[model samples]
Target: MTNSLPTESELQEAWIELQEIHETYLLPYEVKIPHVDQYYETARSIWLAVLFYYKEEQVHKDVISDVCQRDKPGLARDQQVRHLKREGWHLSGKGGYHSLDPFQPSPEWVTERNRRSGRLGAADFTQLKKFYGNACATCGAKEGRPDPRYGQDIVALQHGHMDPAKPANDKDNIIPQCQFCNRAYRSDYVFDDKGRVYAVADVGPVRRASRQVQKKIYEWLMSVFG
Candidate 1:
């Protein structure tokens, strides 16, 4: 089978920020490569799965299983994935779906999928800014306001995709987002016109689940991350 995941070289190229993540956030090695040689392949496979989904939330065990055939296919997917998370990948996984942090720089395919440029024209972006009153559509922060987190820096409105799986340059599916919120949600959620979180990309495992089960999952995540 032709592997669908991006090549390791491509991942390394797109995620240059990963070098910093390794030294600061990740565990054990203070380096990307785990010291234990056997677990290394499993770790590598999980990353490929993450990059495959890119910004899209996914039910990824199957993908992981496929890619890790050469790594550690027999190992439980969650354990391997959690190892990376605990070891320092800023990932979110629960309710059987996983999503990568949106703050990471993404591959070109996001804005230019299927050879269709989603948001190329500066005129379109200019119009979007005007429509949203020159403010971040998601956070309502006016462009050039001082960023609360970045001292002496101003907030800049960016083109954030509503559905990352689709071509992002399309005016219809795009929203004006502050750099903060754009990376905060990624494509993990869907929002409404009022810029409230509307729904998650929970189409798979969450389907047919009881309301109690859903609520428990929600509460569990809150407690874990809280």
Candidate 2:
């Protein structure tokens, strides 16, 4: 009987076909196919090989041999590595490989870190929600309402950091915001002479309101009092 072992090209073709099938049928129907985990593992191995080649700066044959345990022909391996590099796999730094799968701290560690740093806790979240009247500070969208545009439930009020990159997690740096406004604001802000903070228009996602909601509220007050 002739040998039935699959060739490298055959394996690659099969992977492509499986991906197409997943995209066209499985994803749309939300159905899981048999041996799907195997398919995922195979795809991950392919990506890991590419990442290792870039991070290690070794020959494709050496990388693939290490990853796949089989000796691949030189030309095929070279072409594969070249394709990965072209698809944006260039090394950024000595430790750039860590960017592929950054380490995530466990939930317990996160809670302990937050506690040590005085980050908002469950009680603080409840108090903040009450202080904001359970509505978005910018949009006045109430909690539990369905967002008109997306049909998703309005995002629970989030505590936005005045400086997201180096958040202080203090009352002075935190404000209640809707999901839309929080995402749009993203880390861009400016402080006025009086120490009031405002979102920076040029650097952040485009302003969500046509006019300042806070300004409109003040204008209404001035009109009523006068």
Candidate 3:
């Protein structure tokens, strides 16, 4: 027996087969495998069981038992468990497990996942700008002009969630924020009654152009003191 895990295509086929099995025998009835002490109802649990069974043929009984018993057993088992849990399985009873609910990502998770995948493309940015009208929600700065002090784009809008904890890609949840305001808000800055944003703590002197300024200073010193 080989220790190799199934390919993605094989895993997908196995998942489909597991789904079919779940629908046919598990969904309408409470089915339990004899000597296994675990229910195989949901597609996720069924898939895990199948994956574990496949590995059982390749590995020692002690290894399988350890994997089934411990939470963080080893790399292979841990990976399988994580995959199953992500697909909505949960450990249950004294031994083995069950998938209680289907996988449903929170809005925040979806938004983060989309961000990671670069799914918020040009069209999405356009829509965001159109919705918010190219101004920072906090400071009301218009888009495209450079910051006077930083020399960075002041109004270059950034996507930010109204509620960072429950972030969503929806127009209502997202807003166009200026780079300064975005940074300020992220650093726990709060607006005063006069609408002036203040940082929670002193951030020390603002950073300046280092190498360019140094070169310019050197040139000025050479021209003056030469």
Highest lDDT: give the candidate number: 1
TM-score for each predicted model, relative to the true structure: 0.36, 0.31, 0.27
Candidate 3 lDDT tens digits, 59-134: 3333333433332223234324434333223323223432322223223434444454332332576665654456
Task: Note the Cα lDDT for every prediction shown.
Answer: 0.57, 0.47, 0.46
* Residue 87 in candidate 3, Cα distance off native in Å: 47
Ordered from best to worst lDDT, the candidate numbers read: 1, 2, 3
- Candidate 2 segments exceeding 4 Å error: 1-123, 163-166, 190-226
Candidate 2 colliding pairs: none
Give the clashing pairs for model 1.
Answer: 118-169, 118-170, 119-169
Model 1, runs deviating above 4 Å: 1-123, 202-226
TM-score of 1: 0.36
- Per-residue lDDT tens digits for candidate 1, residues 159-195, read 8777766687676677788888887876777766446
Give per-model CA RMSD: 21.0, 17.1, 15.6
Distance from true location, Cα of 213 in model 2, Å? 23
Tens-place lDDT digits, model 2, residues 65-136? 344434232323322323332222332323222212111222343445445443234357666666566777
